[model samples]
Target: MIRPGLTFKLSILLACIGVLASGATGYYTYRANRTMLVNEAGQSLLTSTELLGQRFSAAIDDVGADALVLASLPSTANVVQTDNGLGANAPREQLAQVYASFMVHHPEDLQIRLITRKHYGLELIRFDRDADGLMRVEGNSLQEKGQFAYVFDTLAFSPGRIYTSPITVNHEYGTHAAEGKPTLRLGTPIADASGTVVGVVIIDIDLAGLLNRLQSDLPSDYRFYLANEWGDFLVHPDASKTFGFDKGRRVLMQDSFSATKPLFDQATSEVLLNGLVQPGQAAGQVLAFVRRPFGSSEGSRFIVLGLARPLQDVLSGATQLGNRIIRMVLIFSVLALFLAILFARALTKPLHILAYAATHLFAEHAMETLPLKRTDEIGILARCFDRLRREIKSQMDVLHNKQRELVHLATHDGLTGLPNRMLFMQKIEAAIAEATRREEGLAVLFVDLDRFKQINDQFGHSIGDKVLAAVAHRLTQVLCSADVAARLGGDEFIVLIEGPRSAEAAPGIASRIIGALNEELLIDGHSMTVGASIGISQFPDDGATAEELLLNADAAMYAAKSDGRCAYLRYRDVIEARKLKREQASEGATEGREAEPTA
Candidate 1:
């Protein structure tokens, strides 16, 4: 309220008028500067996150390349073949020294193991750093590790590709980490000449060392964190939060930085959260995260790498500028604030829009083009956000496509492009349900090449693979559209003939498959003639379920091989009669084989 003094009211009016203009100008400038500074801070955070990911990616890639080369050595393959040979001692020693040399050269590596699958996975050669940091090769100390997911899981993948393990406390006794040093493993499969998985080469990485490398050469203020796919912190500034599972309690990154919880839910590979991150964290923690996906056909999903720092450090300069602007504004008359608050809303409008858009982008995985018309720094920030949204979407699409491909590759056979046993079993189970519901007859045909081993011996497995592919194509052509054909591995194949055909027609279908394979195949300029012996088993007649049907069909197929080289056999209820017939047929087959000349 103005004083009754006419001159005082007039003077206050003049002051208000002048301050309103100045306040409006100062407020706009303050907001524009603040937004720009925050934008720059965000950009710096993103850059640091990206640099961390790239550096770590490059380092792991180099390690993986080295692992591949080491796994490819001839002695590595021989180790699997000569596991039981008396002469293996020398070769094993050489491998141990070779791995020891690797650990010596790379002290950050906790252990290097060339392990083969034998009962529980067998360690053919293992070299690990002791608690004293000395690289030691254990020869007679080979232990069974088949139970570890790292050992068996890596065996499922093809050679040359690297598989990474989740970071955890090292549990194996008598090594560098026996005291529970944090560990991670990089594993690559060892393949024989025919591309068969013979063993796996695993390099144990020191997680503490990895964190040091990730933080190397960076500013003293910079901090790095690592987490597994589930967002459980694996590496943290406070070591106690890391691998909390080992302590029987789970402490998650999402729990600390609740803002990033949506990232994992959205399956995004990268994200950045600004503001207070966790309880007890500095009031202005800015955390940026990037996911490092690693696994075989199965997913342990990703290892999240993050770089975090105090936002106060980044905004210190901006804060100083803001204080100067505040001091300038305080010189204004009190009435000016009434108008400034009303006008400040319009200036901060863009900030709210940008914040809303960023939140929506991650939470909903949907986007609307931001208001990009302004020629100010806010507009530039909006443009960057919009671009990031587009890029994240593009990356997610690619990630989804790759995930689908991995799923397909996991279930399908690599050589013949047919469904492998895993997929085949699923289809058979489904087909059995359908048959049971409709009371329709179903057939399971087990087809085995009569002399596939002979073919492999005569003309390397390369030709054998080609022959198998050709046979797969022929089987697809002979079977009905409703039928499912799968390679049960090696030279054996199984087909689930669903509806569109009766059990009586199974023998005919099997015969047709046999006839199709009987034709000469020109594989790699070698005219090859191979015969198939297929056995037919009907659902509810020979067996009730998928496993039972497949088992019966397999037994019947051997009977077909015994009856004649190229023929089909049907499962019957009388096991003894079928056994007698197979025995007599085997005798005849022996006599026939005796008549052939070896040359």
Candidate 2:
């Protein structure tokens, strides 16, 4: 083969370099843009999911409030006590109209009724929305609901407590629009004047309609998802997948999206899924799921709410940028190929400089090494590299700062900037360990604000929050440098005092805290006075572990409250009182046995 000339070789080599550089740059830029877009979309979806969860909770609360309103009505009680609407036609008719009006305004309310316990939970007056409109059900249309859990369970609860039934399809006959539809029933007991549960005011909520209303304001493209605490899909994009249990099958969120397993396990409160990192059906979507507490039950009842958007929609801008990058790469490669034949010798020096700058891109004063001032193609490339480096470094710095902020937020209370229960437990455990090793004693002071609920009800949570923050501030001020104070959530705080004199110093610190809190506080043009009941538990004497110490301290705090507010009680005193009461009970039992006759 004939040997190639120097110009030809240089041109070919430059052409290869240009093509490789352009391809690599274009690929990396596309990748970076896609990643950025995915991150932003994930955050946006997560926010939407959280907002949806909140809206769902608020909607449930509103429904419960409505049930309360109907339950509290004098006419509702009067009609329920009248027994099958005899001699109570006027009140029953008026209540039916009220129910009809509510159904008219709230399209999600499928049926409203007043059912009494006397007639085996017979529906006295019922209004149901049908194809015609809201209408009253009379005569044979009335059904006995005492056998149903919604009626019996509701009657079990005292008045004013709303009982939420498990969401299920309403198979009850003669339900009109609610028949065979997904339904949630909220029932509250209606008590007579003597405080007896006479009947229940029941409202049947159309689950699908309520969800539609909740998501009405969201984007049309965003698909909504909902699952019960068991991870069974209550709502899904595919209609067949929802309520799979009703069809003698099972469809679970965790099975569909493995990333959501943690949500069902209760390991995490939220989950974010990226399609790029996922497979199968999830491969082209970004999804977020948030766990929301459901109903007013004290149990661990919750629902998982999710929102999903197509990945293609989120990367539309990146797609456009990729197209532009492709065009740019082709143009630059062609230009480099033509110019290489003329400037083959001249380009060597700048190429070395660029390579060195690339290696030291993040090094201090590295920009000085780049030939940015030159009015040449190499200079333009160098300037672009510099810009990229700056942007990358800025992004990294911001990421680090955000990571630190997140760590702080996870451990501290946002409202008061104090260590929260989780962080406090960790610190207390470590302190306890150290104290046990050194044969030293420490004190845990449990502080609870008295009448805080009243303050919240009287002035609202805004003023109450300010008062809590003020209390937290005073707690910090009253404690010594060796001591730590933490908020244990909602008008309660805990303190740990280390050092040899911890047990002796705890009483004084608690007294000071009580004094500090008792001082009048002026907030939002209102003067407010709040008092705290404090309890002290000594290390080794009260408990051997962090949990024990906290429990004992909490018990002592309640004892203080029982004695009177604005006072301090010690765990030792609580234990002694319990022991004395036990002894007294034993003595009474002995006396009763001794007094028993021949048997």
Candidate 3:
């Protein structure tokens, strides 16, 4: 056997340690750098998306304000007064000059027309750009705009309020807008001095231009996406996919990004997503943020704005950073191992202490004394071990935090932040066992928001969401801390009331919830009132199981809605009476038919 020198043995040992330490440090640093990069990108994109939504809204509002201002101008009233321009002189020069100057300042205004309700809808004074983009008054080219939805829709709106038409191609015959460029019509009901609806002042907005204006100041690498209320990609980077509805293709943002499906539903206003962005690409992924700009606002159908960047582009620096760190680590490892061999004799005493400490490696500050006593390569090794332990603990803590977040998101409703159907059912199962063991009564109230659909249809989904949120808040306020309130998706919510005395307690609680929600909700400057119909089912009385209770409560709620909404009803009492009445009515109708004629 060859008796090797102490320095030679130490050199071999430190060399082995350096290799392992380099690999461990390199991998940990790489992972940490990548995570940090992704996190920074997420935060940056989220903030940018929020800013973009605000900027988009401000852009639309500016155009709407301008249209209102032009509508209020004296020249607009003059043009409307001269309906059927075949009559006395209409002073067309002043109106032309007004539109010309306004169009000059707001070059995106494609066409500004004062269309009077003459011959159904007559363009009394039309201001449009020529083929060369020069402002011109086409009074001689007057045409009928009665068939346009924008004209008819505006006539119905309150005066001074702008009603924006759906974003679509300019198919109208006499528009200055290019044949296939995306366009939106902003119409303001022009009422003269006497509050009489005279005509509609319409402005054809170049949607493409508006979007470009919104994107002008953004990063060059960032891509913009615009979708309508139905998720149709109105503006896409791929021009072929833009206005896919007009081509009968039905291309949707959700088809590519399922995470943004709820953007229009108002359930998810803003969300960060990561995935294959090119419609059909495997392996590669990009990070994107989708946000709805028109949050609880009137005018203009909902338009969702999304901004996305390639993930690799975001993490470009991480690779370089990792490489540099690995190289530095390798150089340091080589140098430290060389020095470790020179100090091989000094390592003996500390090594003895370390061997003793290593026995209790998992103990708190196990090497505390070693670090304080030694000032050699061994001390450096001890400090590195301590740092590694802390790093491992930190990573473990991060993993645990992520797990907790995942569990929370899994159990809670995205909207209203209430317990979802699954979680609620689980709670009900537990509550049932508890109630059974204690011989106590448990009541489940099924609540369906009444007139919610009407609000969504009449106003918009944004306003509807506000009303739902407000109603949820009010319902929460009326419930005791022990009571459990959960959203069963859509307009349905379930509440589990404990320790109910008699059947009246459930009904009383339902009544208070109904009354609280029925109070006026001021959403986006609109005073809206929504109500709920609640159905009560008690444990061991109406139903013994969660499913049975939920079903019976739902049936009673329907009865409440049928009888007259904004009311609460008990399961058996309300349903049986209605069934008996229906049976009696059926019997009477049968008797009448028998007594009448045999056809």
Candidate 4:
């Protein structure tokens, strides 16, 4: 049997590797795109649900406002308190007409009534909207509603306070179009002139109609859900699932969506669930739910509103992307196979040369021997390698530059771009060592801004930061080339001045700094004046070490503030004051000893 040559073996190996790589890349890209789309869809659904919940709450508020308007009217209270006699007929008729006009405008309101606390919650004036149109219930047609919770519970509420009832199926007799429909009731109490609870103005809302109005603009693919505080479904995509408690079975929202249980426990105000990790019916959907306050009632009442869209629809773009990726992967695999065969034939001598050059890539003139003159695949590969080597060198240069920048940043303040406290200390230590060797005088100035806190509190921190930056610029302008300045925390700066006349020149430098800061600053169209108190300390005379000099200068700075700010003090004065106080105390002790009895 004849065996394959080296070129054939190499071609087969390279082709297999390319095909595997292309397939893996295609799968990873499809999966990543699909995940991103799913997450975005979940967030979008959540926002829609929140918007729906807000709309529902606003609708309830609107109904309450309308009820308050009616309850405040003179005719409603007049009709409620007066007996159903000839004297009350005109006001009752007027109130009935008002209710009719309101019902005509708000078709979602099934019924509006003036129900009294007396006569077993008698319906004084009632208007019901049915299939035909608005109908006014009169005389015996008006029914007593005191036995109903919407009437009795609402009567107990304080005057002007609105009440909202739980959503339930309306089984009341003679409710016309509202009979047997899901209803929500809103009521506000009416008080007489003496503040007596006379009656209530109640508006019964068709729950389905209200939700339909709220979701009218939503897309057709979106499904809506609503649940009471007890987690019972009030509205659902599937009609059979809604009002399950009324049907003697429980199809609770928490039971349907396990993640939504937190909403019932008040643990979370909203929930987002996706089909990827969920099971059963939720396995191919993205759903979001938000809890909304039902009304301004005294009790803690709330309802959950939700929206859902199919995950398949959300990932449709990702699916198309996956199809394109698959086609590209097939095309690349065939191209890779053809190139592998071509490379197997031409790779022999150049491959050895390229391998040797790669090993010594950084060596001097390693690419000088490449076959760059030939216009074939080997020459193209050599040129590509040269370009890659240049790019690698360029990247190394960029990395080195970044490292130098990081070092500078480590030593400088981010806000003022001046040396920070640590860097200042390092600079001072070096200056102290040089001064000690050369016997040169060095001065340390501790500068503190006057009334900076007041400026910060009045103008805010943004302006204060700008002031600090300007102050730093002024300090740099005022100092000599050899001198160093640094920020030592908030509103405090330290400066190092060296040379022969450092001690004598320290005060002049301090005066110049104070003058620079004292000038009025025109920041953000606000003219403000600032000043500085500086304390000067000299090397060898004040203290030998950097820390000792800084401490002395800080003490002197406090002295300047105590003596009235906007001035400079020297550490020598502080030391003399201490010496004078000690001498005075010693003299007083000697006088006391001489004047005492012998003992």
Candidate 5:
């Protein structure tokens, strides 16, 4: 059988295990919750990115349609008029009014330009705004401008039906240096009534505004860039600063090239690899490119629109979610620790009480019972201890009763059933201390029966015992409840009177005791009478200690015996004189005997 102490130790071990297990479980749960939160955040970022891309594409398409409308206007057409004088003298105000109307219709299109092809070369009669908000005329030979060189050299050599190229241009008419601004240029042959091409109409649509507006709707952490087919930076939100003057020039490329360089490398690679316009790409596969070919052109006019988010930013919410999960787990751990301590204390409280009770078992004063109040194993142990306590108490009671009997036998006279000499002296000491404490008087009376020897000699020891019993009974009757009457030995007795009112009180009690003993008789049907001589000593006057009191009382009793052997006497001057005389007579008789005979 396992001891209670060992059982308590095992319970503590099990409780520790439970705490550790709970902590482990809480940590696992926290980690799982954190992972789920991060994954959900990543999914949301991806979804938002796709929606923003669609919105940007729609915005660009809307702006492109408006530019196409302005290109179709006859007033802005590049055809030469049959009547040159009227056409040349036509009011520039009338053309300005038309341009103003176009600007009002397309509020987001920041700039529009018109270029005309002539037999000599390409003449650009462009209406563009300067910083002063005035429309300015820009003219360029088709051979001089690199932007129009693609139209004049390539298409004019091949003589395509209509040609368009998406180009990034710098509007240098103003001091602002609007650098790396993307524009869409459309070139169409101006056909006469006989179907001969007289000139080409060129439309320049500023794509910078469309790209800027598209970038504005993107999230703050996101950045947008448009690059040409050669991986050259075309339209960036910071294009004016990053591509201004000589800056970022090494990274720009013309529109016809396909091999990507460093700056537009990500866009070109995404467009080529994903083939965004291809039909076979999976629906859920993340596409980094969206390609739209412009103006029925083949390769040169294709706009490779790349849309992507940095993997870091897209998964940033995962980091936050993980941290949140960790924080929650930490909080849960703290709570678990707190609860564990509380539960451990609650579980151990009963065991502590039981242990305390068990410790008391070896102490000088043991507890009567264990104080456990639980109903589990601890309570059962307490109940067992209670039973053990009962058994121990039963044995203690038996031993105590036997000890009391032995003490009584050792201190009492067997025949008279009165206190023996040892008990008498002890009682005398107690009485003296009590009288001294109370500042009162106590009387110690030494009692001796006068005819005790004669009764024993004549009627045998059995009759002598009856006489002693009778005298003891009479003494008990005469004494007050506060007095102790003890048989010193045989017929010698002592009575202790506590807190006597006066010396006269002792005499009255003495007289009553003598009278009661004189009336006691009828031992074995033989009438008997005995006289008791009692010598009284007063506390603080006759004696201050038990021995002194007892010796003085004995002296007084002997004096009573010397006087007549019947009446009690208090030790006084007359008794002292008689005692002195008896001592002197005994000495003289001893000297005479010594001198007269050697035998």
Candidate 6:
């Protein structure tokens, strides 16, 4: 037999082994898949960045050339000439037409603006076309053109330079908007034949439009943003319209551009001219970045274009794969548990069968030896059980006989073989319930042999017991089929008579009991005569509960002794009244004794 403790330990060890094996396999599979996914995503991001950079550079070059052409037209001498030459009465109307025409021609360029340097201000010219297909320019004054004083001052100092440069400038055109819209202004210096800088030609493209184009080419889950040297957002695809120059208005560079910022800043510092750098310092940080120095070739303004991809994304993919693997493992675990339980049951089947057979062997008292057919461990157990069965059977026979003797002793008197007090009480309680249900009367008779103590004192207790047994036999013989008789120890006995109609009927059963006791009893080779006084009480009318009825019957038995020695009496209200009077008399006597206790 396997010990219960050992079986439990083995089952737990097996389950743990299964879980550990599944978990380890799941983790490794998840990690491998995740690494591959992140690599793919990084490669795709780098490819898209290259494509977007080419498109953005091309658009910037086109806008720069267009701004230079419009700035040299001599029509921009004043707001009125700029407006009339562009064929619009208002500067804003002329500029709006110029911009509208530009948007129509270059539909991919979402916004186009021409900025001029005059009186330390930027005049915003937009291209518009009339019904005649004639191109017009509208000049709009920038309110915060003072903020861009550095741009004009730098261009004025070196007018010989006329290559593309990236400048971080603040907008002043729209007063209804916020104070400053920071932008990456791509410009080239416009100079005279003598190589003296007259003014800078600026193309004020929408920074957000450029970023939107860049981000749209990337994956849906990834974030893309562009920030200038000051760590301010030139363009943020998520919250684009709110980009500006106030400290509070600056975009959170640490949030959207966090993963790529260090690499971008490093690239900005390294390449004073156009060049490429690795994504990070480590071998794992090998993302490609291209830096194009912005502003004129000989100018103060320089801007770097940064592109990066992190291996952390690969790690994230691996984590997701690990979760999936865990789910699969959990599914397999449930299957394993079910199969393990089935296998365990199969292994324990013989034991279960043996247990059932053992239970039946004891219950049915089978005398045959255990049937051990095989030579396995189970057969050895069966052989052991068979030996155990024979030993138990031998003891069982002795126990059965002893038990029978005890049952007889419990329910019958040792001397009389009549029902004892315990059995009598059980029968009486049952009779009371039956009588109440039938609305009939049950009579409880408390019978005491009269002058029985005289017999015991004159003769020995052996003779006394003989007399008592003879009386018990006589009572049982006289009892009706619906009646019970029991000895209450010594010379006292009780009888329960059910199906009686009234208390009046109780006297007849009691009288029969007394008359039977009056007959001569042969005990110890002598004929002796004894009388019995039986007191009877009826159910429901005499007492509601069992204890009360038995108590009343006992009191009536004493009353029978007081009335005379050898008759029976039925319990009545007078008996209870007499008991009450005796109690009162006893109380009065107690009080009088207390008062007179001085001596």
Each candidate structure's TM-score, on Cα atoms with residue i matched to residue i, is: 0.49, 0.50, 0.48, 0.50, 0.39, 0.39
Worst 10 residues of 2 by lDDT: 1-10
- The number of the candidate with the highest TM-score is 4
lDDT of 4 by residue, 1-599 (tens): 44454557577776677657857688678778877888899899899988888888888888888999999997777778885622347777777788888899998899999888888888888888788998878788878888888888888889878888888899889999998899989999999988888999999998899999999999999999999999999999899999988889989999989789989999999988888757464878988899888675454678998889988898887776689787876687676768777765666677777787899887656788776665666677888998888888889889999998998899998889999998999999998999999999899999999989999999999999999998999999999989999999899999999889798899999999999999999999989987999999999899999999999999999989888889999999978888999999999999999889864
Q: What stretches of model 1 exceed 4 Å from their correct place?
A: 1-21, 84-88, 135-140, 276-282, 294-301, 330-599
Residue 19 of candidate 5: its Cα lDDT?
59
Kindly indicate the candidate among 2 and 5 with the higher TM-score.
2
Model 4: residues with Cα > 4 Å off, grouped in runs = 1-26, 85-88, 297-299, 324-599
Please, what is the whole-model Cα lDDT of each candidate in the order they appear?
0.78, 0.87, 0.77, 0.87, 0.60, 0.60
Question: Model 4: which residue pairs collide?
Answer: none
**At residue 450, what lDDT does model 6 achieve?**
94
Q: After superposition, which runs of candidate 6 have C-alpha atoms over 4 Å from their true positions?
A: 1-349, 358-371, 389-434, 500-505, 573-599
lDDT of 6 at 158: 52
RMSD of each: 30.1, 29.6, 29.6, 21.5, 33.4, 20.7
Q: Give the worst 10-residue stretch by lDDT in candidate 4.
A: 1-10
Error of 6 at 271 (Å): 42
Worst 10 residues of 6 by lDDT: 270-279
Better of 1 and 3 by lDDT: 1
**Candidate that beats the other on lDDT, 3 or 6, i.e. the better one:** 3
The residue-level lDDT of candidate 3 at 173 comes to: 74
Candidate 2 lDDT score relative to the true structure: 0.87
**Lowest lDDT 10-residue stretch of candidate 5:** 270-279
TM-score of candidate 6 against the unseen true structure: 0.39
